[model samples]
Target: MTVILKKVPESEKYILRNFCSLYLHELSNFTMNLDVGEDGIFHYVELDNFWTVDGLSPYFIQLGGDIIGFILLLERPFLNKSNDYGINDFFILNKYKGKGLAFQAVEKLFKEKQGQYFVIQVAENRRAIAFWKKVYNRLNIETHERQDIIDDELCLIQTFKI
Candidate 1:
Protein backbone atom coordinates (compact mmCIF):
# COMPACT_ATOMS: atom_id res chain seq x y z
CA MET A 1 0.00 0.00 0.00
CA THR A 2 1.26 3.42 -0.93
CA VAL A 3 0.83 6.06 1.79
CA ILE A 4 0.99 9.73 0.94
CA LEU A 5 1.81 12.39 3.49
CA LYS A 6 1.03 15.96 2.59
CA LYS A 7 0.18 19.23 4.28
CA VAL A 8 -3.54 19.76 4.58
CA PRO A 9 -4.90 22.10 1.94
CA GLU A 10 -8.20 23.96 1.78
CA SER A 11 -9.56 21.57 -0.81
CA GLU A 12 -9.50 18.68 1.67
CA LYS A 13 -11.76 20.23 4.28
CA TYR A 14 -14.39 17.54 3.98
CA ILE A 15 -11.87 14.78 4.47
CA LEU A 16 -10.64 16.49 7.61
CA ARG A 17 -14.14 16.66 9.03
CA ASN A 18 -14.80 13.01 8.35
CA PHE A 19 -11.49 11.90 9.78
CA CYS A 20 -12.04 13.88 13.00
CA SER A 21 -15.57 12.60 13.46
CA LEU A 22 -14.66 8.97 12.96
CA TYR A 23 -11.62 9.31 15.21
CA LEU A 24 -13.58 10.91 18.04
CA HIS A 25 -16.33 8.34 17.79
CA GLU A 26 -13.84 5.51 18.04
CA LEU A 27 -12.11 7.13 21.02
CA SER A 28 -15.42 7.62 22.82
CA ASN A 29 -16.29 4.01 22.20
CA PHE A 30 -12.92 2.91 23.52
CA THR A 31 -13.60 4.85 26.72
CA MET A 32 -17.03 3.23 27.01
CA ASN A 33 -18.70 6.58 26.83
CA LEU A 34 -21.71 7.70 24.82
CA ASP A 35 -20.89 11.32 25.49
CA VAL A 36 -19.98 12.19 21.95
CA GLY A 37 -23.18 14.01 21.16
CA GLU A 38 -23.79 16.86 18.74
CA ASP A 39 -22.00 19.18 21.11
CA GLY A 40 -19.00 16.89 20.99
CA ILE A 41 -18.90 17.02 17.23
CA PHE A 42 -19.10 20.78 17.38
CA HIS A 43 -16.19 20.78 19.76
CA TYR A 44 -14.14 18.89 17.21
CA VAL A 45 -15.14 21.47 14.63
CA GLU A 46 -13.77 24.18 16.85
CA LEU A 47 -10.51 22.28 17.27
CA ASP A 48 -10.35 21.69 13.56
CA ASN A 49 -10.75 25.39 13.02
CA PHE A 50 -7.85 26.14 15.30
CA TRP A 51 -5.62 23.57 13.67
CA THR A 52 -6.66 24.63 10.21
CA VAL A 53 -5.62 28.20 10.67
CA ASP A 54 -2.74 29.59 8.69
CA GLY A 55 0.73 28.58 9.83
CA LEU A 56 -0.59 25.73 12.00
CA SER A 57 0.93 23.08 9.70
CA PRO A 58 -1.72 20.35 9.71
CA TYR A 59 -0.89 17.21 7.72
CA PHE A 60 -2.84 14.28 6.38
CA ILE A 61 -1.91 10.70 5.55
CA GLN A 62 -3.72 9.60 2.45
CA LEU A 63 -4.09 6.17 0.90
CA GLY A 64 -5.39 5.69 -2.63
CA GLY A 65 -6.57 9.30 -2.79
CA ASP A 66 -8.49 9.03 0.46
CA ILE A 67 -7.48 10.50 3.77
CA ILE A 68 -7.22 7.78 6.37
CA GLY A 69 -5.35 9.64 9.10
CA PHE A 70 -3.96 12.99 10.17
CA ILE A 71 -1.29 14.43 12.43
CA LEU A 72 -1.41 18.01 13.68
CA LEU A 73 1.87 19.54 14.81
CA LEU A 74 1.45 22.91 16.41
CA GLU A 75 2.43 24.81 19.53
CA ARG A 76 0.07 24.75 22.45
CA PRO A 77 0.44 26.35 25.86
CA PHE A 78 -0.16 23.26 28.01
CA LEU A 79 2.35 20.99 26.25
CA ASN A 80 6.07 21.04 26.83
CA LYS A 81 8.10 22.51 23.97
CA SER A 82 11.57 21.61 22.83
CA ASN A 83 12.95 23.87 20.11
CA ASP A 84 9.35 24.61 19.08
CA TYR A 85 8.36 21.00 18.29
CA GLY A 86 5.45 19.21 19.88
CA ILE A 87 3.58 16.08 18.78
CA ASN A 88 0.25 17.84 19.05
CA ASP A 89 -2.51 15.48 17.88
CA PHE A 90 -2.25 12.21 15.95
CA PHE A 91 -5.04 9.83 15.02
CA ILE A 92 -6.01 7.23 12.43
CA LEU A 93 -9.36 5.75 11.51
CA ASN A 94 -10.39 2.64 13.49
CA LYS A 95 -10.20 0.37 10.47
CA TYR A 96 -6.66 1.58 9.91
CA LYS A 97 -5.51 1.08 13.48
CA GLY A 98 -3.08 -1.64 14.68
CA LYS A 99 -1.26 -1.48 11.34
CA GLY A 100 1.71 0.52 12.63
CA LEU A 101 0.63 3.58 10.67
CA ALA A 102 0.87 5.78 13.74
CA PHE A 103 4.43 4.74 14.38
CA GLN A 104 5.32 5.45 10.78
CA ALA A 105 3.76 8.91 10.91
CA VAL A 106 5.65 9.81 14.06
CA GLU A 107 8.88 8.39 12.72
CA LYS A 108 8.53 10.47 9.57
CA LEU A 109 7.82 13.62 11.55
CA PHE A 110 10.96 13.14 13.61
CA LYS A 111 13.05 12.41 10.57
CA GLU A 112 11.82 15.62 8.91
CA LYS A 113 13.09 17.73 11.76
CA GLN A 114 16.03 15.82 13.12
CA GLY A 115 16.97 16.03 16.81
CA GLN A 116 13.77 17.75 17.85
CA TYR A 117 12.00 16.33 20.92
CA PHE A 118 8.44 15.14 20.40
CA VAL A 119 5.89 14.78 23.18
CA ILE A 120 2.39 13.31 23.26
CA GLN A 121 -0.12 13.47 26.09
CA VAL A 122 -1.97 10.29 26.89
CA ALA A 123 -5.00 9.96 29.08
CA GLU A 124 -4.14 8.42 32.43
CA ASN A 125 -6.55 5.55 31.80
CA ARG A 126 -5.77 1.90 31.33
CA ARG A 127 -5.98 1.70 27.54
CA ALA A 128 -4.14 4.92 26.78
CA ILE A 129 -1.37 4.30 29.27
CA ALA A 130 -0.83 0.78 28.01
CA PHE A 131 -0.76 1.84 24.37
CA TRP A 132 1.70 4.67 24.92
CA LYS A 133 3.93 2.64 27.20
CA LYS A 134 4.21 -0.10 24.63
CA VAL A 135 5.16 2.31 21.85
CA TYR A 136 7.70 4.36 23.79
CA ASN A 137 9.24 1.32 25.43
CA ARG A 138 9.72 -0.41 22.09
CA LEU A 139 11.28 2.73 20.62
CA ASN A 140 13.42 3.17 23.76
CA ILE A 141 12.41 6.82 24.04
CA GLU A 142 12.78 8.38 27.47
CA THR A 143 9.42 8.95 29.11
CA HIS A 144 8.78 11.70 31.62
CA GLU A 145 5.72 13.10 33.27
CA ARG A 146 4.89 16.79 32.96
CA GLN A 147 1.44 16.64 34.50
CA ASP A 148 -1.32 14.18 35.33
CA ILE A 149 -4.85 14.71 36.59
CA ILE A 150 -7.85 12.57 37.37
CA ASP A 151 -11.19 14.24 37.40
CA ASP A 152 -13.91 12.28 35.67
CA GLU A 153 -10.94 10.41 34.16
CA LEU A 154 -7.19 10.29 34.30
CA CYS A 155 -4.65 11.96 32.01
CA LEU A 156 -0.90 11.41 31.71
CA ILE A 157 1.88 13.14 29.81
CA GLN A 158 4.37 11.02 27.90
CA THR A 159 7.45 12.77 26.56
CA PHE A 160 9.76 11.38 23.92
CA LYS A 161 13.21 12.94 23.64
CA ILE A 162 14.26 12.53 20.03
Candidate 2:
Protein backbone atom coordinates (compact mmCIF):
# COMPACT_ATOMS: atom_id res chain seq x y z
CA MET A 1 0.00 0.00 0.00
CA THR A 2 1.19 3.49 -0.84
CA VAL A 3 1.15 5.96 2.01
CA ILE A 4 0.87 9.68 1.20
CA LEU A 5 1.46 12.34 3.82
CA LYS A 6 -0.21 15.72 3.55
CA LYS A 7 -0.97 18.73 5.67
CA VAL A 8 -4.35 18.78 7.38
CA PRO A 9 -7.23 20.55 5.73
CA GLU A 10 -10.70 21.69 6.62
CA SER A 11 -12.35 18.81 4.78
CA GLU A 12 -10.41 16.27 6.81
CA LYS A 13 -11.16 17.65 10.27
CA TYR A 14 -14.22 15.46 10.65
CA ILE A 15 -12.20 12.36 9.84
CA LEU A 16 -9.59 13.29 12.46
CA ARG A 17 -12.27 13.96 15.03
CA ASN A 18 -13.88 10.59 14.45
CA PHE A 19 -10.62 8.68 14.59
CA CYS A 20 -9.44 10.32 17.81
CA SER A 21 -12.81 9.85 19.47
CA LEU A 22 -12.73 6.14 18.77
CA TYR A 23 -9.10 5.88 19.87
CA LEU A 24 -9.78 7.63 23.18
CA HIS A 25 -12.85 5.50 23.74
CA GLU A 26 -10.79 2.38 23.32
CA LEU A 27 -8.14 3.75 25.66
CA SER A 28 -10.72 4.57 28.30
CA ASN A 29 -12.15 1.09 28.11
CA PHE A 30 -8.70 -0.42 28.45
CA THR A 31 -7.82 1.77 31.39
CA MET A 32 -11.29 1.31 32.96
CA ASN A 33 -11.48 5.03 33.50
CA LEU A 34 -12.12 8.02 31.26
CA ASP A 35 -9.55 10.07 33.10
CA VAL A 36 -6.06 9.15 32.03
CA GLY A 37 -4.53 10.25 35.32
CA GLU A 38 -4.85 9.67 39.03
CA ASP A 39 -4.66 11.77 42.24
CA GLY A 40 -7.32 14.22 41.10
CA ILE A 41 -5.04 15.43 38.31
CA PHE A 42 -6.72 13.92 35.30
CA HIS A 43 -5.91 14.65 31.71
CA TYR A 44 -9.09 16.38 30.64
CA VAL A 45 -8.96 15.58 27.00
CA GLU A 46 -12.11 15.27 24.97
CA LEU A 47 -11.25 13.82 21.59
CA ASP A 48 -13.77 16.03 19.91
CA ASN A 49 -12.39 19.01 21.77
CA PHE A 50 -8.79 18.17 20.97
CA TRP A 51 -6.63 19.43 18.08
CA THR A 52 -6.13 23.12 18.32
CA VAL A 53 -6.42 24.72 14.91
CA ASP A 54 -3.84 27.39 15.71
CA GLY A 55 -1.41 25.64 18.02
CA LEU A 56 -0.84 22.67 15.76
CA SER A 57 -0.06 22.21 12.14
CA PRO A 58 -1.50 18.74 11.54
CA TYR A 59 -0.63 16.13 8.98
CA PHE A 60 -2.40 12.99 7.83
CA ILE A 61 -0.88 9.70 6.78
CA GLN A 62 -3.04 8.43 3.97
CA LEU A 63 -2.81 5.01 2.41
CA GLY A 64 -4.56 4.39 -0.87
CA GLY A 65 -6.29 7.72 -0.40
CA ASP A 66 -7.56 6.64 3.02
CA ILE A 67 -6.36 8.47 6.11
CA ILE A 68 -4.86 5.87 8.45
CA GLY A 69 -3.06 8.12 10.91
CA PHE A 70 -1.97 11.61 11.89
CA ILE A 71 0.89 13.55 13.48
CA LEU A 72 1.11 16.94 15.12
CA LEU A 73 4.24 19.06 15.36
CA LEU A 74 5.37 22.33 16.86
CA GLU A 75 8.12 24.76 15.99
CA ARG A 76 11.48 24.30 17.63
CA PRO A 77 12.19 26.56 20.52
CA PHE A 78 15.17 28.88 20.07
CA LEU A 79 16.68 28.61 23.54
CA ASN A 80 16.76 24.89 24.07
CA LYS A 81 20.18 23.35 24.74
CA SER A 82 19.42 20.32 22.65
CA ASN A 83 17.67 19.90 19.37
CA ASP A 84 13.96 19.27 19.96
CA TYR A 85 11.03 19.82 17.72
CA GLY A 86 7.79 18.98 19.47
CA ILE A 87 5.65 16.10 18.24
CA ASN A 88 2.39 15.09 19.79
CA ASP A 89 -0.57 12.75 19.32
CA PHE A 90 0.69 10.40 16.68
CA PHE A 91 -1.68 7.50 16.03
CA ILE A 92 -2.17 4.86 13.40
CA LEU A 93 -5.24 2.70 12.92
CA ASN A 94 -4.90 -0.85 14.20
CA LYS A 95 -5.44 -2.31 10.76
CA TYR A 96 -2.28 -0.63 9.51
CA LYS A 97 -0.01 -1.80 12.30
CA GLY A 98 3.17 -3.85 11.63
CA LYS A 99 3.41 -2.78 8.01
CA GLY A 100 6.39 -0.46 8.58
CA LEU A 101 4.28 2.40 7.24
CA ALA A 102 4.79 4.51 10.35
CA PHE A 103 8.53 4.20 10.02
CA GLN A 104 8.39 5.21 6.39
CA ALA A 105 6.19 8.14 7.24
CA VAL A 106 8.60 9.42 9.92
CA GLU A 107 11.60 8.85 7.74
CA LYS A 108 9.98 10.92 5.07
CA LEU A 109 9.35 13.62 7.64
CA PHE A 110 13.04 13.85 8.48
CA LYS A 111 14.07 13.71 4.85
CA GLU A 112 11.74 16.45 3.71
CA LYS A 113 12.09 18.81 6.64
CA GLN A 114 15.28 20.66 7.50
CA GLY A 115 14.77 20.31 11.22
CA GLN A 116 17.69 18.96 13.26
CA TYR A 117 15.66 16.94 15.73
CA PHE A 118 12.30 15.23 16.10
CA VAL A 119 10.96 15.06 19.63
CA ILE A 120 8.00 13.06 20.92
CA GLN A 121 6.54 12.28 24.30
CA VAL A 122 4.83 9.02 25.08
CA ALA A 123 3.23 7.74 28.22
CA GLU A 124 5.57 5.44 30.16
CA ASN A 125 2.96 2.70 30.27
CA ARG A 126 3.27 -0.69 28.63
CA ARG A 127 1.76 -0.33 25.19
CA ALA A 128 2.83 3.21 24.42
CA ILE A 129 6.37 2.75 25.68
CA ALA A 130 6.73 -0.44 23.71
CA PHE A 131 5.38 1.09 20.57
CA TRP A 132 7.59 4.17 20.76
CA LYS A 133 10.70 2.14 21.49
CA LYS A 134 10.02 -0.20 18.61
CA VAL A 135 9.37 2.60 16.19
CA TYR A 136 12.40 4.62 17.23
CA ASN A 137 14.69 1.62 17.17
CA ARG A 138 13.44 0.62 13.75
CA LEU A 139 14.04 4.18 12.58
CA ASN A 140 17.39 4.45 14.42
CA ILE A 141 16.22 7.32 16.61
CA GLU A 142 17.70 8.06 20.05
CA THR A 143 17.39 10.43 22.97
CA HIS A 144 19.77 12.14 25.36
CA GLU A 145 17.51 12.45 28.40
CA ARG A 146 14.02 11.72 29.67
CA GLN A 147 11.48 14.48 29.97
CA ASP A 148 8.90 15.32 32.61
CA ILE A 149 6.01 13.31 33.97
CA ILE A 150 2.44 14.25 33.32
CA ASP A 151 -0.41 13.51 35.72
CA ASP A 152 1.65 10.84 37.50
CA GLU A 153 2.35 9.03 34.24
CA LEU A 154 5.98 8.89 33.23
CA CYS A 155 6.32 10.78 30.00
CA LEU A 156 9.12 9.44 27.91
CA ILE A 157 10.83 11.93 25.65
CA GLN A 158 12.73 10.77 22.58
CA THR A 159 14.59 12.76 20.00
CA PHE A 160 15.71 11.80 16.51
CA LYS A 161 18.48 13.77 14.95
CA ILE A 162 17.80 14.59 11.36
lDDT of 1 by residue, 29-93 (tens): 44444356655561354555645454356789877787779977764443345535665567777
Q: Stretches of candidate 1 above 4 Å error? A: 30-34, 39-43, 51-55, 76-83, 115-125, 150-153
In order, how many clashes per candidate? 2, 0
Every model's TM-score: 0.72, 0.72
CA-only RMSD, every prediction: 3.7, 5.1
Q: Each candidate: what lDDT?
A: 0.63, 0.63
Q: For model 1, name the residue pairs that clash.
A: 124-154, 124-155
**Any runs in candidate 2 off by more than 4 Å, and if so which?**
29-55, 76-84, 116-124
Q: How many pairs of residues collide in model 1?
A: 2
Q: What tens-digit string does per-residue lDDT give for candidate 2 at 1-162?
A: 667789877667777766666556545543434553454333435433335434455688888888888876554443254554566667788888788887777767766764545454435345756776776677676655566765454566766666
Model 1 lDDT on a 0 to 1 scale: 0.63
